[model samples]
Target: MITNLIKTFIELFGDSNEEICTFFAPGRVNLIGEHTDYNGGHVLPCALEIGTYALVRKTANPFIRFYSKNFPETGIITVSYDDLSYQEQHGWANYPKGIIAAFQQLCPIETGLDILYYGTIPNGAGLSSSASIELVTAVMLNELFAQHIDMLELVKMSQKVENEYVGVNCGIMDQFAVGMGKRNHAMLLNCQTLEYRYLPVSMNDCSIVIANTNKKRGLADSAYNERRAACEAALAKLQKHINIASLGDLTSEQLEEYKHLLSPLEQKRARHAVTENERTLEAAAALEKGDLARFGELMKQSHISLRDDYEVTGTELDTLVEAAWKHEGTIGARMTGAGFGGCTVNIVKDESIPSFIEQVGKEYAGKIGYEASFYVVKIGDGAREIAEAKEMSV
Candidate 1:
């Protein structure tokens, strides 16, 4: 695939003498924690083997030219470094442009480049494709400009691009997982403190299967911001009655005691944040002890909280998860990303994967009247430049 991408880049930009380098950043799937990132809570997420790839070469021009094999209709979208503001007409190009604008704040970007991106992650699947783009661009620039910035700082800068430039009120989970992911491990992140530790993913007989609902969700235009705003308001009300910094700071018992301080909607939102944070911590403990059954139970409870308290999962997500629960070999299943409609992360026994996919796909189609896609993915490393041989395997 890298060979073909290189050929395409050369064909479009002419045979330039500059050396071309390739980079990769993987997409992420949250295992248990949902709608808790911006609430200053804990989250569990892992990077997938499938993500966005970039083939780039430096140029003397003052403008950056962007192309994507995923969206051929857009062709090559060029942007001058002077004008990096968001533009609706630019479509997907805004993501990369946002990162460039962010990097310009740290160092001077004097020369431009030609970049070709090919992503395996499905668009609107809520797998952090946008963050994948942001991190990949940030890593590429870090290499090109020889800016020896710390990886954690790059993660923060990528989150800034999402919040300030892309206009999404997202938390640090996605960017952090994309930038700091380790192979065969899931990160336990404290969003408020930015402290994290990787827990080994040692499901010896189980595999991680991602099932895409095929229902498109636009995050910037979705109710994601409204939920964040609701949580913020709830935290403010709780502060007046108690001494706490965020929803994550409160326990379930404390939240029940102070539940009257917030409105009905605020109470539910706060409850989800507080309880979900606790569940994430417990889930991590369960995994640490190699108790898959306990982890699966926590995962089921997490989905119920997200569906009832958070009110983010719609019919599609609920249907898929409910279907998965019917399978006896299923260990756990839940909507992975910021709900509405996206994919679900499930742990199924190796021998049951085939039957799980067939039955789940049939049930989903019968109810939702459309086919869903499934992929058995392995946990992968974080963003970086890919070597030629490694690129072939990726």
Candidate 2:
């Protein structure tokens, strides 16, 4: 894959002799936390080996040329280093453009370059493909130009690009996981304080399975913003009765005491954020104690809260989770990501993976009238330049 990608890059830019560097940023899957990041809650996410890769090299020209193997139709997007402003016509390229525009404000860009991109993650599958692209761009520029930016700062810059430039109002979990992930580990991140620690993921007998529902949902246009608004409104109502900064700051007991202060809709929204935050902490403890069963149970509860209180899980995501739950080999199953129509993260015994896939796929296809995709992924390190280009996959 690296050979092919490099060959294509050379063919496109026609600069075989010039120095080219390979940079990668992995997509992330939240193990338990959902819709809790923006509410100042904790999130458990791990980076996957499969993500976006970029082949970049400096150019003498004044304009930067961008090309993607994934979206060949977009052709080459040219932008001047002087003007990195967001352009609607840029489409997917806007993600990288946003990062460059934001990053250039802090660091002085020296020259233009030609970049070719390729991604293994399924687009619109809620795997943080956009975040992967953003981080990869940030890392690439940092390495090529020696920007000396901290990893956490790069994560923040990526989130800023998403929220301010892309207009997504997203939280920092995606970029944090993508930028700071470590191999064979999962990060427990406090979205409020930006404090985090790495927890060892020792699943010797089980595999992490991601099942995509194939129902496309765009975060910016979806009810994501509305849900954030609801949580904010709920927090405001609770603030009148009790002093709290965010929903995550409230405990389940405290929310119950002030439950009457919020409307029914606001009550539900607040419940998910608070409860989900607690569940994430419990899930981390379970993993640390090597208690997969307890961790799985927390995952199931997280899905239920997302379905009932959060209302982000649609029929497609629910169907996948329900089917996975019925499987005897399944330890726990839950809808991951922003919910509407994404993927479910499941823990399945190594021996039962084949049967689990066949059975779950059949049930999902029969009910949803479409086949869902599955990938057995392994936790991988965060964004960095490959010392030597290599093939990437699960």
Candidate 3:
């Protein structure tokens, strides 16, 4: 991936591109719990090497011209600093335009940009590509204007654009992880308080292998909202019997104490979230102590709850997890992102990753007949300045 970036960077800079700054934001991979983010629960996620890069230069004209390498198309949108709106002709540009809108809210803005974006992260693969784009754009604008916004603040602004403008009710996990992830570590984030720490990720002999299910998540569909609403209902019902505000606060025993107040199905969903949050905390500690086996056990249990209790895992996702478990030298496997089909996160022995990929792909192909896309991702630094170029001369 770094070699490919070096090739593209040389190409982009070799041409007459003016003075440019390329901002990057990483795609995140959750190590453990799935669908536990928005419920005010704990999730272990790290920034991926796969990320979005926005190559931009200051423009003389009031208009901003946008080009996408993925789409290989050009879009020219004229924006008035007086009032910024293109009448909702939303596309790849909206991700950047939303950042401009946020800048305008705080103070007077000076300039627009001519942006050429080339991204490698798979779209709709539960890898948070959209968040990567939004966060990187925000970082670009910040450096360009010297806005000096803090890290978490930038994460919130990026999230707001996705939620209010782009329309996705995602939690802070993706944005936060990408915005603040440390190299060689996973973030132990407390969603309720917005405080986080980098938990040491000991992948000395293991590889974090991701298998994309080739299925897209229909988050706007009923399933996503249904689970969210179920958690809310459980909180409301449990509040009468317990003093807790959210399921995040309730103990495992406490959750069971008020189980009778909820429908059998809702209780199961709520139970999974409460326990999963606990597992994430324990898993973080296990990783810190270099106890991979204990952490692996937590990941395996996470998949079971997501499948049986949360009811998010589909047959393909389940099959992928099962295949990884059966493969020797695999520590743990679970479905990542908001289920209904996305990717499975697996921790496999570094030497065995190749065989595990081949075997899993071959067996899954026979069962599902669809080829799975594998991504071997590692923890990378969060968003920051690209001070010195990577020696662009050929």
Candidate 4:
């Protein structure tokens, strides 16, 4: 995946690039919960095998230069770390810029760099591309300066970059998973409290297969904001009768008792949140009990709710989920992450991964005009830094 990074660094820096520092942060797939991060609910996510990698070296000038072989563009921005508003190419360089802004708050930085980045995590399949870049940048700066920032603090700093600088109203899930994910386990994150547990995901002879629908939904889109507003409206309505702050606190009976208090749209939003929370808990229990069928059933139900109530799933996402559902080797399938058009996460038997891929690719393409791309992934480790071969010169 990083063939280009390896090739280009050798061309630009040198064959061995002996002075460069490398870091990686992974994109993630949320298994059972969707759209619940901001609502103080639980989610299950893990780092993918795919990630964004960076190679960095320090510079004497208070300037940062970034190279992207993937985009065929180079970014140059000069600013004191104290004045972090400076930006280069806003598209991809924004992530590194975000980390610079975030880190300046915690550490003293003169803020000049020579960085080259290449990534394998698909850009818009709901796999936290922004978080991947930010974490990689965080690791790079930490190692370059010998700051030795703790991994958890590094994650919080990256989250601040998104929340305060890059301007994405994201929860801690993406950064946390990118920072703390362990091999073969999904991170069970309590987004509000930031307490997490590693849930071992030993899918016996199984793989997490992501079906990419090739439709990108930006969270800045009005519709996504509308969904959030709808959920907030539901919470406001529920608070009058339930004495609860959010849908996370309401039971199905409590919701039924206050059913008519909310408008139809708000009611649907609240219903999805409450049910999704319940399903997440159930799915967690299923995993603990080794009940794949129950977990799978909850996943299917989750997609239906996300499609109908949360109103996030698009036709492509629905079709991919349907294709996976119809497959023999798949235990459960759902449109994962913040949906509209993204990847469908499927729990597939390892032996059937190939046929499942082939059949689903054909079936999804037959239904939709576009062919679905499949990624067979396992949960992997979080952010890591490549120790420098020699002390770098500024």
The global C-alpha lDDT for each of the candidates, from Candidate 1 onward, is 0.92, 0.92, 0.80, 0.80
By lDDT, the best candidate is: 2
lDDT of 2 by residue, 9-121 (tens): 87898864567789999999999889889999999999999999999978778888999988999999999987778788998999999988887888767777899999999
Q: Better model by lDDT, 1 or 4? A: 1
lDDT of 1: 0.92
TM-score of each: 0.98, 0.97, 0.91, 0.92
Error of 1 at 276 (Å): 0.6
- Model 3, position 345: C-alpha lDDT score: 93
Candidate 4 residue lDDT tens string, 1-394: 3444555665765443335667787888899878787777889888987888887766665677667656664434344555557354456677788787766767767746778887888778788888888898888888777787799998989888887777677778888888888988887787777778988887877888988998767765537667888888888877776677667677777888888999998888888988888899889989988888899999999999999989888889888888889989999999987787878999998999999999988988998887888999878889887444224311
Ranking by lDDT: 2, 1, 3, 4
Q: Could you give candidate 3's per-residue lDDT for residues 1-394 as a string of tens digits?
A: 4345545644543444456666788889999856667777778899987788877777665766666667644444455666656345656677777777887788766665667676778877888888888888888888888878898899999888877876767788889988997898898887777777888787768989999988866555538777888888888988887787678787898877779999988899899989999999899888988998898899999999999999999888998999999999799899988888889999999999889999999888889878889988888988765655433422
lDDT of 1 at 216: 92
Candidate 3: C-alpha lDDT? 0.80
Alpha-carbon runs more than 4 Å astray in model 1? 389-394
Local error of candidate 1 at 211, Å? Answer: 0.6
- Pull out the clashing pairs in model 4: none
Model 3 off-target regions past 4 Å? Answer: 1-18, 73-89, 390-394
Model 1: how far is 50 from its true place, Å?
Answer: 0.6
User: Where does the lowest 10-residue lDDT sum fall in candidate 4?
Assistant: 385-394
